[model samples]
Target: MLHLRVISPVSRTEDVLAMLRVQPGATHIVLTRGGALDPEGDAVQADLARECADEVVDALEAMGLAHTGAITLEPLDTVISDAATRARRLAPGDPDDTVVWEELIGRTREESTLNATFLAFLTIACLLAAIGIVTDSPVTIVGAMVVGPEFGPLAALAVAIVRRQGRLARRSLLALVVGFPIAMAVTAVGALAAQAAGWLSLERIDEIHQVEFIYEVGPFSLVVALLAGSAGMLALVSSKSAALVGVFISVTTVPAAGFAVVAATVGQWHVAFLSACQLGVNMVGIVVAGVLVLVLHPHRRRAFRGTQGARPDRVW
Candidate 1:
C-alpha cells in the first residue's frame, strides 16, 4: 500500500476529491479545506494500493497538480484496516509488477549522481574485495559485494538508455567512467600495503576457488550476470530491495576488479588480464540483462512510449 499526500488549489479541490472517490484502490480519504498557508489550498490524504499508484499520479500530473500543488507517495509499513484490504483486492494487478515510474526515476536520479560518499564507498568496497581475494575467503568477498555502490550507477545507465534521457545517460556514464578506475587504483595501493604488512601473498591467488571465478572469464559468468541483473532490477522496481543483496553477491563485479588490482600489483600480469576480462564481461552482461528486462515488461513499454511522446516541458 502507498500513502498519498496531495495539495490541491482551491478550484481543483473538488476535482481531486471526485477523482479519488471513484478509484477503487483508494480508501480513507481525508481532506482539510483551506488549511494550507504556503500555496493557499486544501490538504488531502489518502491510502491507495501500490499497484494503482501510477494511474493516480498520472492523473494528478495531467491535472496540473504538479505545477500549482504537489503529490507525494510514501510506502506504508503497515495498513490494518479492512478498507486497505479491499483497496488491495480491488487493485487491477500485482503491486510488485507495477511500474511506479515517478518513484523509480526519483530513486535512480539520486543514486546515479556522482558524489564523495559514492566514491568513498566504491573504493572501500573494492579494498574489502582485494583483502578477500588475497585471503581466498568467500565470506569476505560477499561482504565486499554488500558494500559495493557500483550497482546504482550501472542500473541508472540501463534506465537512461530505455527512457532516452540524455542528461541522465551522461551522468550515469560519468559515475561509472570515473568510479571504476578510482576504485581499482585504491585497491591496488591497498594490495601493496597488505603485502608489506605480511597480511597477503601472491601464493594464495593460485589455489583459491573463489579467486578462479574472479580471474577466469567463462560462459557461466554471463548466465549469472543475466540472472543477477534481472533480479536486481526487479528488486528496484518492486521496492523489494532485500532481493538485491543476493544479486550483489551473485555477480562478481567488484570482486573481479579487486582481483585484477591485486594480481597486477604483485606482477601477475596474465592473471590480471584475465581478471580484467572477467570484470568487463560481467559489466556488459548485467547492463544488457537490465535493459532487456525493462524493455520486455509491458507496463514499462507503455511508460517508455509515453515518456518519449511527452513534450519537453513535461517531466516524469
Candidate 2:
C-alpha cells in the first residue's frame, strides 16, 4: 500500500476529493482546508493500494496538480485498517506484481548519479576481487560481487531506454563511461603498489585456478548475466529488495573488472583481454535483459501511455 499526500489549489480541492472518493483503491481520505502554506491550498491525504498508485498518480498529474500544487506517494509498511484491506482487495492486481513507475523512476534516477560514494564502492569491490583472484578465494570474490555498485547505472540505463528519457539516459551512460575506467585504473594502481610491497607477484597468477572463471569468457557468462538482470529488475519494481543480494552475487561483473586490472598490472595481456571480454558480455546482457523486462511489463506499458498527456517538462 501507499500513502498519498496531495496539496490541491483552493478551487481544485473539490475536484481532487471527488476523484479520490470514486477510487475503489483509496480509503481513509482526509481533507484539511487551508492546510498548505507554501502552495497555499487544501491538504488532501488518502491511503492507496499499490496496484492503483499509478492510476491515481496519473490522474493527479493530468489535473496539473504536480505543477500547481503537490502530490507525494509514500509506501505504507503497516496498515491495519479494514478499509485498507478492502481497498487492496478491490484493486485490479496483486501488490507484489504491480509496478509504481514514479517510484521506480525516482529510485533509478538517484542511483545513476556519478558521485564519490559510487566510485569508492566500485573501487573497493574491485580491489577485494583482485585480492580474491590473487589468493584464489571464491568466498572473497563473492564478497566483492556483493559490494560492487555497477548494477545501479546498468539498471538506470535500462529504465531510461524503456521510458525514453534522454536526460536520464545521458546520466546513466556518463556514470558507466566514467566510473568503470576510473575504478579499473585505481585497482591497477593498488595492484602495482601491492607488487612493489612484495605482497603480490606475476607468479601468483599462474597458481590461480579457482577464480579463473572471472577471465574465462564463455556462453554461460552471458546467460547468467541475462538471468541476473531480469531478476534484479523484478526485485526493483516489485520492492523485493532482499532478492537483490542474490542478483548481485549471481553475476561476475565486479570480479571480471578486478581480474582484468590485476592481469594487466602483471603484463598478462591475454588474460586481461579475456577478462575485459567477460566484463563486456555481462554488462551488455544485463542492460538488454533489463530493457526487455521493463518494455514487456503490461502495467508499465499502459502507465507509460497514460502519462503521455502530462507536461513534457514534468519529472516523473
Candidate 3:
C-alpha cells in the first residue's frame, strides 16, 4: 500500500474525485477543502487522501486532467488505528515498499545519462573487476561487483518498458551497448600491459576453473539477475539505499566484462564468448524482471498540497 496526497483547485475536485472513485486499489480516502486568501473567483483548494495498492501513478499523470495540479505522494512509515479490527482491514503490502512511478523513472533518467559520472563509475567498476580476474582474487572481484554502474542502464531499460517511454528505452540500450564493449576494451588493454610487465602470464588464462562463475552462462545466472532486478526496482520505488547496494552486487556484468578482457588478452576466444554470453543473459533477465514488477506497480498523481514537513496522520 502507498499513501497519496493530492492538492488541486476546487474547480477540478469533482473530476479528480471521479477518477479516484474508479482507482483500482485506493483505500482510506480523505478530503479537505480550503479557500484562497485573495478570493479572486472561487479558485479554492481541495485535498484528497488515498491509499492505493496498484502502481498506476505515472499513467494517471499522463491523463492530462489533473496534470497541471499540485500533488504529492510519499511513503507513510506508520499507520496507527485505534480499532484492532479496523487495523486488520489494511492491505498486506507495506506502504514503505510501494513506489511512485514517475518519481522512480525520474531518478533513473537523471542517472542514466552517458556523462562523465557514468564513465567514471564504469571505469572504476571495470578496472576493479579486471584486477580481480588477473590476480584471481575473490575480494577484488566482489569489490568490483559493488562498484559497477551497470545497474543504471538495466534499471533504465526496465523503466522504459514499464512506462512505455521510447526515448528512455533507446538511451538505456545505448548505454549498455556502448558501456560493456568499452569496459571490455579497457580491461583488455590493461591485461596486455600487465602481461608485458610480467605481472600476468598468458598461460594462466586457460586454468580458470576457479573463476568459472564469471563465465558460466546458464539458467542460474538468469535467476540471479531476475532477483537482483526485482530488488533494484524495489529499492528504487521504496527509496531504500541498502536495496540498491544489493542490486550492485547481484549482477554479473562487471565480472563477465573483465573475464572477457582477460580472455582476449590471452587469445582465449572460447572463454571470452562464454563470459560475454553470461553478461548478455544477466542483462536480459534483469530488464525482464524489472519491467514485470514496475508494470504491477504503476505511479498515480497525489491529491494534497502542503507547505513543508507535513507528515501523514497515523491510520492503519
User: Could you give the candidate ranking by TM-score, starting with the highest?
Assistant: 2, 1, 3
lDDT of 1 by residue, 1-316 (tens): 8899999999999999999999999999999998778777999999989788878887887788888998989989899999999999998889889888778877887988889999999999899898888778888988998999888888887887777777777888899889999999888778888889887676766667765777778899899999999998889989998998899888888988898899888788998898888888888888888888888875775576557545463332
TM-scores of the models, in the order given = 0.91, 0.97, 0.70
lDDT of 3 at 300: 22
**For each predicted model, how many residue pairs clash, with residues at least 3 apart or on different chains?**
0, 0, 14
Candidate 2 wrong stretches, greater than 4 Å: 313-316
lDDT of candidate 3 over 1-316, digit per residue (tens): 3456555456665665666665545545566655323321112121112224233343334333234455455555555544322432443344454555446666888777787777777877888888888777778888999888888888988877755567877878888788777767777788889999987776676555566799988888999999999888878877786888878877788888888888878788898899889888888898898887766663322311110112222001
Cα error, residue 79 of model 2, in Å, equals 0.4
| lDDT (Cα, 0-100) at 89 in candidate 3 | 45
Tell how far residue 197 is off in model 1, in angstroms: 4.5
Candidate 2 per-residue lDDT, tens place, 40-78, comes to 899999999999899898889888899899999999899
Could you say which candidate leads in lDDT?
2
| CA-lDDT, candidates in order | 0.85, 0.91, 0.67
Hey, what RMSD does candidate 2 come out at?
1.5
Instruction: Tell me each candidate's RMSD, in Å, in order.
Output: 2.3, 1.5, 8.3
